[model samples]
Target: MNTAAQPPVGEKVRCLACGEVFDASISVCPVCGASGEWLALYVPETNAFRRESEEIFLIVGGGIAAVSAAEAIRERNRLCSIVLFSEEAVLPYNRPMLTKAMFDSLAEEALAIHPRSWYEEHGIYLMLSKRVVSLLPEERELVTDDGAHFHYDKCILATGASCFIPPIEGTGLAGVVAIRSVTDAAAAARRAEAGQNAVVIGGGVLGLEAAWALKKAGCHVTVLENSPRLMMRNLDAAASALLQAAVEESGVAVVYSAQTDKINGTETVESVTLRDGTVLPADLVVVSCGVRANTALAQSAGIETGRAVVVDEHMETNLRGVYACGDCAEFRGVNRAVWPVAAEMGACAGANAAGEAAVYAEHPVPFTF
Candidate 1:
């Protein structure tokens, strides 16, 4: 049941044209499109892993996906060694709360998934403030930003996405920001003071949430949406109109069908100019367009990727002994950047990595913001 790395599974399959090592099962090299004999397999001896030695499962990322994966792995095999590398200094916490309740006076410890002692008690190694730089799939190794090298029998990538800042001028101004991390939330809270003007770009969930937060902070808030309606992906015209009305009743202004040409000011941002020649005055602006998957590490390892890392039903990547989940992974060419989907994928990936049988089927239900 344990889908551990076996002979030829974790081996290097090189492309004759690109000279890149990809998955053997891939008939054509994902990089150069070489087919047939052009793809060659090379399996090495399993001397690196002794039967008596304990197996190690390495997870790169520090989000819901990574935390869920660790829990799933522990549930399957208590004796196996597990190391979770997180780029953030803090422990995993409720990410959604960062924007949803930015103004709420939440204590630092309250954000964590569990107390620091939980990982120790569960025998999970939590490596905080560590960023994995490169992946050597052929050697089953990963190198951290600090020059630390780690070897693993099975590895899972939960490297979550980053905010997508559009190509808008004046983003480098003093008050412009994106509410993605805890630190960002703190900054926004400090800036969104009473008597100040704030504009939020993008009418998505985060944008609307941020607008609400700023409004709650006693600032005059305006939401600029490029689309015709708010939450267009989730709500139809009628629903969007109702939601917009509700939001406006809360003392927030909504602008729709807007095309931002530039954010202008002498020093700090003073106004946002739309393509239609209308200008909105603002002291601060928050951009909440969307997010892009962190696929640089996976791509460097020759792992097949589209918008996100591609995975099979077992949550395993094309490369054997490797798996990917969360916003950073694409299933059947679609990436669902929602928390529920990420957690499900992570659980399936972790269970399979621990030699437990678990299959991941995409959620049939539709998502709404």
Candidate 2:
């Protein structure tokens, strides 16, 4: 189960329009606007599987930490089975590239680090498009959407975070998208047409990235922020201004100190009205406001929660044999949800799950994306 690339009931399906391999069952594309139906089915030619001894059911919430943890476990326990369960379709892929490579016209290669055979040779099971619905920490088990439960010696909750969309009046409109994952990114591209007015809420990294991606996709992009400046949490005004100017130079609009209220339209987003009585027309609205960690499964299982899943220095939770990582876990009082740290934590969690004392020391990982 752990050493193969099949999810509980899923596999790779290549997209015909973008020519990228995406999870077939995942309804939407994160890179392209292609539907899952557009993902050409490649019927398995054979049932050949390369499995190993000792199954380690690793229920990963986010792909990066889950995959990194699997590699670390494989480094020590070569014969142990590794199951990498991710809600994200892409497995162990880099999140940073969603910004830099979004407009790269011919980039077929995904942000994934390892090839398919790498998992096969090493006996790693990749479960893409699999969302863990509940956790049984007492039983050391996790339940999937399809009602299948997996028992584990160690379980990693890398479930990550979901983008927070403000409770705006017109939020139910058709053209609004949350640019958090690949699915959102691709939908934004399709929802926006050439010369359409697109408004992005929040001036965070994902907002800026979505602006760039939408602009490349031929939409006129405008960013709305309630903060007095851009990237307020990460950069000072001067640095933010430099980035703002750069984005504006690329034909994107940046409006600061603007509080958003509702997206206005009949069936789709047409304009946005601010709390301060300002109105701006928009054909598409991308919400990159903030992120809330997905801890429902853990919370349901009675695991204590803080801002996120409360984990110790070793990525272990309050419960024994249960661990948390990625965007969901707050470890050693640090709540930074960057990609690199998630991978590091995952590796540590996996090692500990395999009966080793893996310490998850905090490292200052740079975050430009």
Candidate 3:
């Protein structure tokens, strides 16, 4: 007797926290770790317009923005060649999960934004561990660090951002780390040991998350904020107080108005000395400073850059046929550098590049912690 096959088990769901669309079977948003409450049933609008062409679409950086651009392009054009270049050795994954789920087993398969089979089925080429060193906009060509060259009809620069580590003495210590990538998170996790003293510099959301993760790993975690309060930019006074209480209740110590003079150690991180002369014993130090947009490649190509590469509403750069999005693109002098904004900008850029009309509108970012 023949048995009936099981129907598909998951539907498309949009994460409210980061605007990432994923299968609903997943309990938490793979991008931002938002629970089911932040997920909404989503039915993608089918674009009836399709242009079959041999044009090559090139995307730099393997972040959410690059993935979204590829998806948007595939949605509009089925025959175009799409190639994505990434300096990372692995496929695109949810970056926010790096800090939010620091201690978890982040196997590439579990963290990937889309499975490897997804790229193969969609005809998108994955050029991993390839860093684009030069952009020749006039010739519509790109040169990688390894001297490989590729030509494109249209290009999107989503080089994203790099973590800014402040100049502090002893930062080169072995136990001092920053949480920026899966590899960085793994290094931090390896250093987090029971009964160890972990000092986290910066009291932003990312810093707090790392502190909590270290605390969970049985490390004595202390968060040092240079500002007067925690998340001063994102939270009001009352909310900040409430959050501070909650964080302290979770067994993580919080310090305000902290200025680090230097990290102290002979070989590894031994302690952190504040400007006030108070020294906090630390076995490991995690720096959660902010990030700066990666705009050197665009700047070298004569692209206009203020805080980042300037872009119009369509996410197109001053150079025609070239576009930028994510942390690398600044529109109206604003770049929130958030996941949702990056995804929206990338979708807009991809649509316009595919000969479809799409505009990006700035919106207020929703904060969920």
Best by TM-score: 3
All models, RMSD in angstroms:
14.9, 10.4, 2.7
Give a tens-digit lDDT track for model 3, residues 76-159.
889999999999999998888888788887789878988999999999999999999999987899999999889999999999
CA deviation > 4 Å runs, candidate 1: 1-53, 365-369
Residue-level lDDT for 187 in candidate 3: 92
TM-score of each: 0.83, 0.80, 0.96
Per-residue CA lDDT of model 1 for 13-103, tens digit only, reads: 7655544444565565543346877777755323222122278999999987898798788876767899999988888776767876688
Report the C-alpha displacement of residue 260, candidate 3, in angstroms.
0.5
Put the candidates in TM-score order, highest first: 3, 1, 2
Over 87-197, each residue of candidate 2 has an lDDT whose tens digit, in order, gives 766656656555545554212245565667778887888887787788877677878888998888767788887788778898888988886666655666667678888
Candidate 3 accuracy as lDDT = 0.90
lDDT, ranked from best to worst = 3, 1, 2
lDDT scores of the candidates, listed in order: 0.83, 0.73, 0.90
| Model 3 bad stretches (over 4 Å) | 1-7
Candidate 3 clashing pairs, residues 3+ apart or interchain: none
